[model samples]
Every structure is written in C-alpha cells, then in structure tokens.
Target: MDSTKCLPRLGGDSSFELGLECREIAKTIKTRKIKYFGHIKRHTSFLKDVLEGKIEGSRIRGRQRRQWVDDIAEWTGKGIRQCTVEAQDREKLRSVSCQPLEQGRLRE
Candidate 1:
C-alpha cells in the first residue's frame, strides 16, 4: 500500500513524520473494541471478563500473547483501569481515543 497518501507531505527536512496507516487502522479497531466493551453489561459479558483479565488460568510457557487491553493502554498512554473508567462515558472515550491520532504520536 502507498503510505504517502495516508501521510502529509513535509515542506522541508523536518524531523516529524506521519505514522503508518496500519497503526492508524489498529488504533481505530482498538477504539471500537473498547467502545463495544463499554456498552456490554459487566455482570454477564464473558468478553468483558476476558478483556479485564478477570478469568483465572495459567498460560502455556512461551512468549506471552498480546492482549487487546495492552494495545489500548500502550496507544492511549493510560492504564487499563483508567481506560475502563473513561470508557464508561462514550463521548469521553471517543475523545480520548482520538487524541493520539490527532497529535500524530501513533508511532511505536
């Protein structure tokens, strides 16, 4: 895919560079996932439990698996508990989720 179209052109030799489209897409997906999780009733949602790591079990020994919550935390610069609290308010969650993208800090 052509990343240039997704990125802004710089006028000169500046240090700033646009983030990858894949990162942007991942961010969007993470936002949507969190929003959906927020809408679910915490009492009966298995997915919510999984997202919050409420289920207790040992993982097989190897490289640790990546988690949705971890991705969201890394992207938003917020802890999972803070994210969960903010996600309770749909509008607030949306605004917070979009902040990194707006500031062009989506790079790893």
Candidate 2:
C-alpha cells in the first residue's frame, strides 16, 4: 500500500515534539475504529504518561511520526483497531472493538 498517499497531518507544534503530535494523531485515528467510532477516547496515553511524568519518556523518536501516521492510516483504512495492552487501556475501550477483516471490503 502507498502509505505516503494516505498519510494524515502529524500534530507538530511549538509546545511539543512529534512524539506529542503522535499522541494527538493517535487519538484522532482511534476515533474511526468500526465499533467505537463515536465513543470518548484517549489521545496521548503512553505519551500522556510521558507528559505527566508517570513514565520516563516515549520510546518513539520524532523522525518516525510520519511513518507512524502512515501505518495508522493503513490500519484504519482496513478496519483494524489496535489498543494499548495496559489494563487502563482496556477499561477505556468499548466492549466490542472491531478487529481487522481478512479480506478487503467490496466496493463498486
């Protein structure tokens, strides 16, 4: 798949690095998951921990934000919803989350 073509804007701004931007975009991307599109969701999460000092820092390098966005775009386009495995992440999610379909959706 041409990931570059499907890329959405990574939320980079003065207050934070692309890591923080990654978090915001992740939050936005999570919004489209099939079974939970309209539900409230977390944006930063791991990154939020970084900001809040609960964790040391994000392992994600700033240079990778674009690729991350592209990967998420592909996954979301295909209806694959990925959740962080932390117990809190599970609690934050909707009960019946959508998994990826083996075959692509039919189209005209």
Candidate 3:
C-alpha cells in the first residue's frame, strides 16, 4: 500500500484536527495593533506623541511608506482623527478591534 494514498483518509489538514479554522498571521497582527493603539491613546506616554506627531526633517526622495495610524484607519474604516477619539473608550475600541476581516472589509 502507498503511504501517500492514506494521507487524505487520516485527515491531512492540521486545522481540522485542531478543531479551529486557520487564520492569517496578518489578521492577527492587525488585531494586536488595534488593541495596542487603544492602550497608547488611553495612557500618557511618549510613544503616543511619536504616533500622532509629524517628523521635522527634510523629506526623502522616494515613495513614502505607510504610517502605523494609516494601517489602523484602513482596518477600522475610520479616519485617523476619529480613531483617536474612539480609542478613548476601552469597550468601544475592544469591540472594533475584535471585528473579523471579510472580503477586504471589516465585519461590524
């Protein structure tokens, strides 16, 4: 008997055996980022300033990279300013952060 032929019968998919659907690492990272954004916004820290402040220097001659806040805004479907306001409420932010990504958009 060929061992390869028995693989499917033994449940070759690890996710099925684990009793959980596999999730992309990108989704997990986005979720953590949203939570961390709320934490920083709620507390008084230098990191908060760095996140919200613009750098004072000459611009580099190349395509600009995406900002951290921009990622949060895109993921949440909200403006950066609005995100800052909403982040003040822990419960609201937690709910928003936990929303699952679907079809390139977040589920309410």
TM-score (C-alpha, index-matched) for candidate 3: 0.69
Ranking by lDDT: 3, 1, 2
The candidate scoring highest on lDDT is 3
Q: Who is ahead in TM-score, 1 or 2? A: 1
Q: Quantify all predictions' global Cα lDDT against the true fold.
A: 0.62, 0.39, 0.77
Model 1: residues with Cα > 4 Å off, grouped in runs? 1-27, 41-44, 53-57, 101-108
What is candidate 1's lDDT per residue for 23-108, written digit by digit as tens?
66766776665556557523457765565554458778999876656656776777878877877787877787556433333334
Q: How far out, in Å, is residue 43 in model 3?
A: 1.3
RMSD of 2: 17.9
Each prediction's TM-score versus the true structure: 0.53, 0.21, 0.69
Winner by TM-score between candidate 3 and candidate 2: 3
Kindly give the stretch of ten consecutive residues in candidate 3 with the minimal lDDT sum.
99-108
> In what order do the candidates fall by TM-score, top score first?
3, 1, 2
For candidate 3, the per-residue lDDT at 80 reads 83
RMSD of 1: 7.5
